[model samples]
Target: MKVSLFITCLTDLYAPTVGMAVVKTLEHFGCQVDFPADQTCCGQPAFNNGYPEHARTLAQRMIEVFKKADYIVTPSGSCCAMIRDHYPHLFADDEVHQPEALEFVGRTYEFIEFLTKILKVDLTPYRLPEPVDFTYHYTCHLRGLEMTGDPCIGLLRQIGNCRFVPLEKAEQCCGFGGTFATKYPDISGAIVRDKVQCGNRTRAQVMIVNDGGCAMNIGGAGHRYGSTFAVRHAAEIIATALEGGKDNARR
Candidate 1:
């Protein structure tokens, strides 16, 4: 299976480790992974901000980059969703890129969804040494995008000896809606505060979010308040499990 990595812009900058772990994890599963340097942002930020023209420009660039890959896997659900669900609309009137846009969307998959659903790779060989307990924050774009039917809970369950504590109102947004956080800092902070409080109430050492934007907001707030909890992306946890990391790894 040949897979192309669509390293989202946020991951490329803020969390490059996530991109590395994704490549390592896929290769561990016996799949050949390629990184297309030509790839850029998936255009979600611009598109969501109502900049269709700008979004289309980036989307077209991305489409051409991975046009020949058998599968295009991305670590970020929100970006994958934007490409899979929104790119078609963005290019609907573009006679040159419409078909290419559809082709790209047809092959895109979120990391966990691709791992568990399409690849169906057995995770029993992966092992985690510590029994880190965490409450997961299911970002809205992931749910709204329908990337995974289970919002990553099922995939986490497959890891050996990892404890997943359920967050009250786990489906609630962490209030980091890309530019939404910047535009409405107070409201975003209030929402993240509530999310951190919920994670703390669960008594979990860490909170895991699928999207980097949400993780940054929630994790940043936790850091500012000196909250006992830390934040991690699902990919990092899974990668750690694969490597048999420490017995008390939180993030």
Candidate 2:
């Protein structure tokens, strides 16, 4: 498939390796991936904060940037959910742009969802060096957009010797709602603190997350709170598993 990588701004900065891994994994599956240089934020930051004008402006920019792609994929589920789930409402008032916005929605997908749902990737070749206990967190946006199976777990299960350490509150929000954390520090901190406690209770060596924002939020708090767990992106963990656990060497 001809794929265009969204490369969310947060991932581009805080987690470039995840973006790189996404590329490598897709290429391994014979996808022709293209990164459009002109892409910018998916306008989710502004949209979530009730700034429709600013959000709409960036939405238009993004639409124009990836207009020709056969399928648009991004490592961050939050960004994909923003464009796929929210952009239509951003342009609903304008009849002219609504059609284009809807068109964009049809071709957008979250990274793991694309692999499992669209590509039907054969995971028989992927394997881990040894079995390791791990847990995954689903960001708010991902759970909101994805109504079915856990794509992250589905992909992770493909790797031999890796076992999922399930979290009882796996669906709980990690308190990283973009500006929500900044606007309400106390509430955000408390919620994420509980999340860390829960993950640490699982005794999982690493916590896997799909959204860049969630990785930063939960991962950052995990460090601050001294949780006995390392935070990693799904792409990173998957790429490592595919490489026979080379990512473990870095840890």
Candidate 3:
């Protein structure tokens, strides 16, 4: 299938490797992945900060940039949620853009959601060179997507030589609500501290978080709190497993 990569602002600026990992993983599953260089921020930060006009400007750019893509995939659940959940509402009053906005939402899928729901790609054939114990952090934006179960955890379980430890209060927010972390540092700090403590309790080698914002917030908190596990994106783990396994599937 043809897939276009929507490298979200956080992933583009702070975690480019996560974007690369996503491409690697998708290509391994026989997808023809391409990056649209014209794509920019999904206006999530501005939109969340109550700047609708500025956010709409950026959203319009995104709508036009990836209009031809058969599937728009991104590593960050937060960005996917922004496009899928908020874009329509942004253009609700504009009859000209509302239909385009809805089409954009329908074509976009967060990375894990694409893998488990659309591709249904079997990860059983992949194995890691060494066993890794990992737990998942369910980013708040994922709730916006209305996903039913823990698809990331399920996919992680499919990999050989990896242990899936249940994170205590797995669905709890990591306290990074885009500008929410900056505007309310004390509240955000307190919540992230609790999130790191929960991950530490898991005793896992790494905590898998698909959203860049949450990962940054949790990683910062983890550093201050001296968290036991490293923070990593799911795509990174999957890419590593695909590369290490004997049945390497990339084209």
Candidate 4:
């Protein structure tokens, strides 16, 4: 499949390694991946900050930028949720742009969902270099996308040497609701503190977060709270598993 990577602003600016992992994982499955340099923010920050006009402008540009893409993928669930769950509403009154917005939503997918759903990927052959006990935090926006099931956990189970560490309150938000974190630092801090504690309780080696913003918030708080686990992106973990599997097969 021809896939266009929508490297979200947070991923592009803060976690470029996650972007590389997404690309590597996709290519390992025979995908033709390309990056659209003109792509910009999906206007999520502006929309969340209550500036509809500015958000609409950015959404319009995003629609135009990836007009030719066969499939659009991003590592950040929140950014994908902004496009799929909210973009149509942003252009609902505009008859001219609403259809395009829907089309944009149809093609866009969060990284893990695309792998498990659209690609129907089977990672049963893969194994981590060593067993890893890891927990996952489902980002809040993922529920908005109707991904109520544990697709990510299901995929993680396929890695032979990895253990799925069930996180307490996995569905709870990590307190990184874009500007919500900044606008209410105390509330955000408290929420993330609880989240990090939950992860700590799992006693896992790493916490896998699919959204860059959530990873940043939880990772930082985990450090401050002296968490026992490291925070990681799902793509990075999957990439590591696939690399190990490839090396083992070569041997």
Task: Report the lDDT tens digits of candidate 1 across residue range 2-112.
Answer: 999998888899988988889988987878999988888888889999998998888888988998899999988789888877888888888987987898898999898
- Candidates ranked by lDDT, best first? 4, 3, 2, 1
Q: In model 1, how large is the Cα lDDT of residue 62?
A: 90
How high a TM-score does candidate 2 get?
Answer: 0.94
The residue-by-residue lDDT of candidate 3 on 1-251, one tens digit each, is: 99999998789999999999999999989999999999989998899888999999999999899999999999998899988888988999999988988998999999999999999988888888878999999888888897758788899888888799989988788899888899899999989999999999999999999999999999999998899999999999999998876564321
TM-score for candidate 1, residues paired by index: 0.92
- After superposing all C-alphas onto the true structure, candidate 1 shows an RMSD in angstroms of 3.2
Model 4 Cα lDDT, one tens digit per residue, 125-220: 888887799998989989887888978989988877778989999888999888889999999999999999999999999899999999999999
User: How well does model 1 score by local distance difference test?
Assistant: 0.82
lDDT of 3 at 178: 81
Candidate rank order under TM-score: 4, 3, 2, 1
- Clashing residue pairs in candidate 2 (N, C-alpha, C atoms within 3 angstroms): none
| TM-score preference between candidates 1 and 2, better one | 2
Better of 2 and 4 by lDDT: 4
Clashing pairs in 3: none
* Per-prediction TM-score: 0.92, 0.94, 0.96, 0.97
For model 2, state the Cα shift of residue 123 in Å. Answer: 1.6
Model 3's lDDT to the true fold? 0.91
lDDT of each: 0.82, 0.85, 0.91, 0.91
